[model samples]
Target: MDIFIKIIYAAISILVATLYGLILIGIVHKIYARVHRRIGPPVWQPILDIIQTHGRKVATSHGIMFFLGPVFRMAGGMGTYLFMPVIFGSVVFSNYSMAGDLLLVMYFIFFGQLGMALGAGEGGHPYSPLGIARGLSQMSTFELPFSLAVISIAIQYQTLNITTIVAAQQGGMLNWTLFTNPLAVIAAMISLLGMNMHSPFSLVLAPQEIPIGPPIEMNGSFLGILQTNRALFASAKLVLFMNLFFGGATNLPIMMLKTFSIYMFSVFIGAAFPRFRPEQSFRFFLRIPTLIGILSVIVIAYL
Candidate 1:
């Protein structure tokens, strides 16, 4: 019965994540339609894209590891969602939260990225050369500030558990860490934007320049897993961000609303700006928000 219950919850979590992906794709479709002055695919277009791609043939290389890459990447992401707390509710894997710290979570995020990078590089496509370069460059730019911001919060709460962090925000919006340290929030937001591969910071693909980045060489069922992985990881990252600062929702609608709101806000910002040059992105991360993150930590420590 315990195993059955966990399975049921896991399935529900997946369903919720799928619906969230559909919503994000739908919004992108609407935004593109408005921008190009033409009707776009239906809201369910991404769903169709996923299904159609799942059965297509893929070039086999790197033997088993090539296929294992997406599997491991997606599995890691899915396991992360199980361990990560949503709202005040305990997650199935929450019991192990004490075994690791926020730093562990941060490392796991890198693991997910590394998996994609390895798979992309191993695919033997010269086209992905620029993609790999951009990905590494982008990672260097974003990781510092992101790490500092997490450290700041971890220090403030004196614990690395996601649940405890959310609990700290219980008095209402003002008690939320965002209000306590707006600069940290800003820095973290900048980092999150970059991490999610969104614009301004989204130099990895640079639609006008680099194309789809590391995933450029991929197709078929492998691409399907990649798509699902991206969508699920994106949703999980958004939720993690919210819980980190704004606090997770006690209600489902509000939680979804928060997730969608963040995603849309990201899209709006992405649409508003052109891509940054590699050097420009590096400087922005190192000189600007990086300093802000440091200062926020200092300030929050005093308070």
Candidate 2:
């Protein structure tokens, strides 16, 4: 009965996270409309887009693996949300806590990326080559400072459990992780900008450079699923980042607002800047964020 309860809880949590992500896509679409000075599609636009694309023709791949890729991506993302702490005193799947550290979570993120890369390769499209290369390169470049920033947070709190870290920030916003380690937050903020694939860091999918990057050849139903999942993943990332620094609030709307604020900032920056060359992105990631991460460690160590 205990195991069965856990299963049901996991399912409910995954559903909540996925739907929350979908709603966020709607929210972002509205934000984009405002930013671009045109009325964008409805908040439900992404969901509609995916539904319309369902069952349309697609480029066939090495059969089962190609079919499995998107499914796995969605599953992995859902799995990720399962482990993440949602509110004070609650995480859906407690067992995942045993292995859910900054390092483990990072690895899960990479695992999803690798799965997408392999699936793209199996599709045998010319653009897939470029997309995978660009994706991998971008991932490699930003990972250094991102890792360091996570390490700094772990050190400060003296624990790797994300739930504990967020719970510790109970008093007020100033006591939040962001104020406690500005440099680390800066590094994390920059890394998130890249990880979110926003403007200056959008070398991987620069329309002029690679045109949608890893998902270039994907189309129809498969592409639709991938697109929906992309938005879902993006929202989930924001939640994870917020939980890291802001602490989980009992109020859902407040949490949503905070997460969307960070997301909108990214989108605004994206609209304002041009894409970076891969090399330029790598350099920026390394030099500035690494400096911040290092400084954060120093501050945390003695202060």
Candidate 3:
């Protein structure tokens, strides 16, 4: 009975997260449109797009792996969301956070990417491979600084459990890791720009050159699954950042505001800058952010 109740709670949490994720994507599109001085789609545009994609009559698949790619992607996104404690101490919103720690969260976040890469290889499209190569290359580059920053925070808190980390920051805003360990925050936020795949780091999607890259061949229902994953994955990443650097929110409204603010960091940067070449993006992450991450580790060790 207890296990069944937990499962029910988990299901509800995922559903809510999915809805919130879609709304956030819609809001992001609206913001992007406003920046360009154009009328934007409705705030519910993402939901409509997903529905249309899912309703399409035909979809092409390239072997079993190609068919499974989007499935793996959705699983990855949902799994990541499930493991995160959404509203700090809320019982129903906790999801399955006890099943994993920060290390597992990091691994789960990359699980979908690896699955998608395999599926892309099976996609049998020349551009798909090219996009995969660029995406993987950039992923490797950014993961260094991001991982190091996470390690620094883990060391400082002496626990890989995200709940405990959030609990530690409860007293005041200054107690947040962002204020207490600015170096790690800086390193992480910089790497986050690449993770978000915004301008300057948007080489992976290179629509003009690669026609939207790895998922180029995916259409109809498959594309809809990928679209759904996009919403959940984006929200999960934002929640992870909020838990690590900003203090985790105690309620739904605060959570939305904090997550949106963190998301805007990438949006504003993407809007103002041009895209970077794959190699340029790689080298950029290796430079300043890497140095800051290393310094953060050293500072934590001394203290």
Candidate 4:
């Protein structure tokens, strides 16, 4: 009975996170449209898209791996969200937390993308492999600064448990990692621009370069699953970043506010800048952001 209740809570947590993510994406679209002086679809457009896509019949089939790709991607998004506590003190919403959860969360982030890559390879589309190559290489490059920043915080908190880290930030804004270790936050937030795959660093879905990259052949439910994961994965990344750098939220509204604000960082940058060439994007992360990440770690360890 107890386990059953926990399962229910987990399901609710997932639903709430998914809705929040979808809404956030819609809001960004609206914002982007407004920035260009055009009316945009309502904020509920993304939710409608998911429903519409799911209703489509798959016209063709790939192999088992192709079938499993979206499933694995969804699993990766869920895995990323489930292990981290969503709120600071609310047991019903906090979800789960454990030692070394940070590392696991990072792995899940890459894991979902890789799953899609595998499925795309099976897609046999000539462009799928090309897109996969670009996406993977870009991901590997951005992960460098991100990994360093994560290490810096892991050292600052002296633990890999995300809950403990969030707990340490409670009581005031100053207690947040943002203030305590600004350098690490700086590094992480900059790397976030790449992780979110916004302009300049938008190499993976380089529609101009690779015709929107991987999942080019995905249709119907396969496309639906990938789309859904896009929201889930984006929200999971935002929540994790909030908990790590901005201090975890105590309630749903606060969580929404913080996460949305964090996401805006990328959106604004994306709009202001044009896309970079793949090589330029890779070089940018490896040079400045990587240096910042390293400096952050050194500051935390020695200074």
Candidate 5:
């Protein structure tokens, strides 16, 4: 009965997290529209879009791998969310956080990207591989700084447990890593801008040239699944950042506020800047953020 209850709780948390993610996307769209002085779609637009996409008939398939691309994407998103505690002390929202630590979370985060890359390769679209190549290149570059920053935090706290890290930040806002370890936070936030795939860093999905990039060949239900995964994945990333830097939330509303705010940091930058080429993006991540990440490690080691 205890095991069954845990499964039921996990399902609820995943469902809620997915829904919140969709709403967050809608809010992001609204913000973008406001920035451009144009009327945006309703805040519920993503939900409607997903419903319409799923309702469309898929007339074809590019073999088994193609079909499994969205599956892997969704699995990656769901798995990442499950491994992170949502509401700290809350019983229901904890999910499977105890089953893994920060290292597993990092691997789970990359799992979907690799899976999607494989699926995209199976599509036979020239642009698909091109986008995947650019994405992987950019990922490799950013991962250096991001990984270093994460390691620095782990070393400073002397643990790789997400819950433990958050607990250490309790007491007050100054306890947050964002205040104490500004260098690491800066490195992570810059890497996040690239990870979010927005303007300036959005070369991977260069719609003007690639017509939506990697998932270009996908349509109908498959497209819908990818969209759903996007929401979940984005939210999961925001939550991870919240836990690491801003201190984890103790309730749903605080979680939404912090996550949304962190997400907007990317959106605002993306809206203001022009897109960077793959090479340029890679170099940018390697230069400034990498330097900061290194300094963070040095500071943590000494102090």
Candidate 6:
């Protein structure tokens, strides 16, 4: 009975997180539209899109891997969110957090993309592999700084348990890692620009010579699943960042506000900055963000 309750609670948590992500992305489209001085689709546009795509008939299978690709991607998204504690003190939203779950969440972030790469490769789209190479290379480069920041937090907190880390930040805003260890926060925030796949870092999916790279051949339900995973993955990343840096929210509204604000940081920056070449994006992360991340770890661990 106790185990069943946990499953029910976790299911609710995931449902809330996934739906919240979908709505937030619709808001993002509106923001981007305003930034470009155009009226965008309604905030419900994303939901309508997913429904429309799913309503279509799936094409004949390309291969087993192709079918499994989006499945693995959705699994990866759920895997990242499953163990994360949502509202810190709320029993309903706490999810199933446990020791070392942070590491697992981090791994799942990459897992979906890797699975997509394998699946897309089987699609025989020539551009799929081309984009995957650039994307993987860029992901590896940006991940360095974010990984170092995670290490710094672990060293500072002396535990891989996310709940413990959030507990320590309780009581006041200054106790948050944002104030306590600005370097790691800085590094992580900059890396987020890449993680969100926004301007200067959107070579793989943005308006390039070959756009919508990996999913270029994906259509119908295949495309819908990928789109859905994007929302969940992006929200999970934002919520993780909020927990680690801004201090975990104790209520749903606070969580929503903080996550929305954090996401807007990347969105506004995307609007302001020009897109970087793939090589340029790779080089940028390897430089200053990497240095700040290293310095953060060194300061937290040794200083």
- Candidate 2 segments exceeding 4 Å error: 57-59, 91-99, 206-210
Alpha-carbon RMSD of each model: 2.4, 2.4, 1.3, 1.4, 1.2, 1.3
Q: Write the per-residue lDDT of candidate 6 for residues 1-303, one digit (tens) a residue.
A: 978998899888888887899999899899989989999999989889999999998766789998888888898888888778888988777777863478988998889889989898888888888888988898899899999999999999988788888999999999999999999999999999999998778876873365667787778999899888888888889889988999999999999999999999999999888899999999999999999999999999898
Give a tens-digit lDDT track for model 1, residues 70-110: 87678756655655665456564232444554666676677
lDDT of 4 by residue, 1-303 (tens): 977887788889988889888999899889888988999999999999999999998877889998888888899999999899998888777777653489999999899889988988888888899888888888999899989999999999998889999999999999999999998888889889988888878867854455777888888899888888888889989999999999999998999999999999999999888888888988988998899999999999998
lDDT of 3 by residue, 75-126 (tens): 8898888887989999888888888998888887788888898997898989
Consecutive 10-residue window with the lowest summed lDDT within model 4 = 203-212
lDDT of 3 at 256: 88
| Angstrom error at residue 264, model 3 | 0.9
Summing lDDT over every window of 10 consecutive residues in candidate 3, give the lowest-scoring window.
203-212
lDDT of 6: 0.88
Cα deviation at 73, candidate 1, in Å, is 2.5
Please give each candidate's TM-score.
0.90, 0.90, 0.97, 0.97, 0.97, 0.97
Residue pairs in clash, model 5:
none
> Per-prediction count of colliding residue pairs?
0, 0, 0, 0, 0, 1
lDDT of 5 at 112: 88
Between 1 and 5, whose lDDT is larger? Answer: 5
lDDT of 5 by residue, 1-303 (tens): 998999999988888888998998898889889989989989999999999999999998799999998899889898888898888888898988888899998888889888999998899989898888888888888888989999999988999999999899988999999998999999999999988989988878765565677898999999899999999899889999999999999999999899989998999998899989889999999999999999999999898
Q: Which model scores highest in lDDT?
A: 5
What tens digits encode model 2's per-residue C-alpha lDDT throughout 221-253?
A: 777778766766776677778878776655667
